[model samples]
Target: MKKRSFADLFFLLFVVYIVLPVVATMLYAFAGKWNKTILPEGWTLKWLATLFQDTAFIQAFGRSVLLSGGAVIIALLAIVPAIFVIVLYFPKYEKWIQAAVVMVYSFPGVILAVGLIRVYSQFGVPMIVVVLGAYVIGILPYIYQGTRNSLRNVDARQLLDAAQLLGASKMQAFRKVLLPTVYPGLFAGALLSFSVLFGEFVLINLVVGSRFETVQIYLMKKLSTSGHIASAVVFIYIVLMGILTFIIAKLTKQAKGATNV
Candidate 1:
């Protein structure tokens, strides 16, 4: 009974810690003028209206979408097939793939930005292109995990062999049979990767700041100019992340249900 009480109290504190800032930020966005009191003196949608009216914010948001969406597509095209081959045929090579995924965690945003700049800067390619490439590699873990997990439940080898025995080519077998079976897990991974890249600020800012302003870069600029606007930006970002998280949960649950069958 005592332990349960302590646990409940601990969780209440944790909830407050996590939720207080978000609530405050949301309040500030709608706040006409909040100063020194428990709540805003007045509330208005002026900040949100002002934010939407900004052309720079719209462009920055688009750039973020392009960068993140492009990376996820490129990763899907490149990594998904490789992982499918690895998991279905050469399971021995999976350890190597796992090692590469582990190495991705070792490179933080700062280190990753610096490393990519060093290697690619000399080649005279566009910095944004370089950033896009890094984004693909950055999301490998998600792509690998999702694809690999989806493939794990099914007897992929036997399924493929049976498909081939029925006079289908390997490519045909993969496209028709394997791809559909593992799609939920793959979709989950893709969404996870997109959400992660969408919020990425460090690498892009460091690589090409003013030259290519993402939503994150725009938010940084707003920080010095207006607290209300910044709060609106953060609130929007949090809401977006929450939405993605919900979708990812639903997809993951669906994948598990499929696996059980």
Candidate 2:
């Protein structure tokens, strides 16, 4: 048998750290009645059925999807073009822009939520507007960093020259050449932000008010009212997120392959 290296050991530990909570949650979710006892009494699908039957859970799930989709679309539309412009035309300011984006990322979610609430209350903006704003601010840093890295890796000069050589317009070059290169990174950023946003509660709670319950908010409610139901909701949430992550991972992988070819 071969001996494991320190890196391998660390990697194994990291995997365990990631999976432990998920594994425990899955077990509890299946257990019909897991209490303060050492182990669950038995396993059943009752929790899953109860979870699906809840109308509020279904609505919250839809809202999360709508909010996340809107945020990602808006972020990409604004961020991608802006990053491209900065990298292509004003390379000198790349460092400064990157620094600013990093600083934006450092803004705590709760604090940002609080600020948004004050602004919204004064302006008479609806709760949905505030929720969308929070989503955009929260995910901007991820999108920015991903795009910046993608731009760094791609050769802007080559793209420009190719376009000119082929008699393609600037817009064509940007659309065809530049976009293809950076899409994988951008997709990755969007996916990461989506994963985080799906489960996000702090900002949404503060900005939209507790009356508007998202999936996470619903889970919080269940923890007190019905822990078994909460566990079930969490299990479903994990499955949903895992599926999303898997799709994004596949998309990113395909994007990388296309870029390579």
C-alpha lDDT of all candidate models, in order: 0.92, 0.80
RMSD of 1: 1.4
Q: In candidate 2, what are the lDDT values of residues 19-111, reduced to their tens digit?
A: 988788888888876668777888898888988888998998888888888888898888678777887888898797778778777888788
Model 1: residue 174 alpha-carbon error in angstroms? 1.5
Every candidate's CA RMSD:
1.4, 3.1
Choose the strongest candidate by TM-score.
1
* Lowest summed lDDT window (length 10), candidate 2: 252-261
For residue 183, model 2's alpha carbon misses the true position, in angstroms, by 2.4
The residue-by-residue lDDT of candidate 1 on 198-233, one tens digit each, is 889999999999799999999999999999999998
Q: Extract clashing residue pairs from model 1.
A: none
Model 2: colliding residue pairs: none
